[model samples]
Target: MTGNTHIVGGIAASLAFAQISNDNPVLLVGAGVIGALIPDICHGGSIIGRKFSIVSKVVTGVFGHRSFTHSLVFLFLIGALLHTLLTNDSIIAGILVGMVSHFILDMATKNGIKLLFPLKITVRFPITTRTGGAVENLVFAALSLLSVYFGYEAFAGYF
Candidate 1:
């Protein structure tokens, strides 16, 4: 999936999680965007990758795309780091949820993801779509609608 898809997916996931965490919506959504782009750090051309080129280069050099960064290992490691650094558990939850959304979105692609990495196995759903293809666009649309719905739900009583 492209960056936009990840962003929308992240937003949707974050909003859903917000219902439980009750964190600041803005903070969670912003963290969601960061989380969405983070997994793509293995690709120097990706949004987060371009921003942090040195780390991107190193991670890509060692793990390549869709390997370590997309794995549960990276998730927990990042999760641990975020837990230690960020005082807000809700923000950490939003970020992790967004990252999980990224994994799920990529899992929809033809190449899939190495969720349980260092094991050399690829995991994907039964059906897959081409990245940036029509199906992916439809998925993007669906996620957009979901984001809207979740967003409304999150802010319903407040507004």
Candidate 2:
């Protein structure tokens, strides 16, 4: 999926977390946004990649695009690392959830992803739509609308 789609998914996931946890909404939202963009570090052309081109290039060289960094193993490892390093449980959970959301969204695209990695397994949805195609765009739009609604609800303390 495109960066915008990731952002939308991130926001939606964060809002869901907020509803469930009822903690500080802003911080969870921020973590979710970061988590959404974190997986694309291997692409070298994504929004996060452009901002940190050198790092992205190095990672891409080592893992290649949509490989280890985009896999479930990587997500678990990163989540474990973050949990060990960060003191807050909410933040760690938010990041992990956001990353999961990103991975799931990417899997929905036509190209799919090596979600298992190292094992050479690729999972995709039956829809067969391109990453940034009309279907993805529509999904992004729906996510955006949901995000807005949730954001408002969060701010208003309506969950």
Candidate 3:
């Protein structure tokens, strides 16, 4: 999936999770965006990868795209790290949800993702689409709208 789609999915996931965490919506959503983009750090051309080109190159050079970074192991490790480093559990939960959303979204792609990693197992949904194809664009739009609705609902009590 494209970074935009991943970001929107992250926002939607974080907003939906807001019903439970009820933390700062803005902070959760921001963490969600960062979480969404973090997995793509292996792809040098990806948004997060471009920002950290050297790291991207090193990761991609060693593991390749949709390999280690896309794995559940990576997600768990990152979540653990975040939980230890971040004082707010809500933010950690939001970030983990966002990263999980990224993994789920990637599972809908044709190439799929190595969910297990180091185990040479690629996991995907029954239905799949090209990375940045029309279907992905539609998914992006739908997720974006969902994010808006969920965001509004999550923050409604504040306003």
* Per-residue lDDT over 25-47 for candidate 2, one digit per residue giving the tens place of the 0 to 100 score: 78888888899999999988898
lDDT of predicted model 1:
0.92
Residue-by-residue lDDT tens digits, candidate 1, 1-159? 999999999999899888887688778888888888899999999999999999999999999999999999999999999988989877787788889999999999999999999989999989999998999899999999989998998889787
TM per model?
Answer: 0.96, 0.92, 0.96
Candidate 3 residue-pair clash tally? 0
Relative to the true structure, how large is the alpha-carbon lDDT of every model? 0.92, 0.85, 0.90
TM-score of model 2 vs. true structure: 0.92
Give lDDT tens digits, candidate 3, residues 55-101.
99999999999989999899989988987788987678778888999
Candidate whose lDDT is highest: 1
Model 1, which residues run further than 4 Å from truth?
Answer: none
Error of 1 at 47 (Å): 0.6
Identify the superior model by lDDT, candidate 1 or candidate 2.
1
Give the Å shift of residue 40 in candidate 3. Answer: 0.5
The CA lDDT at 155 in model 1 is 86
Off by over 4 Å in 2: none
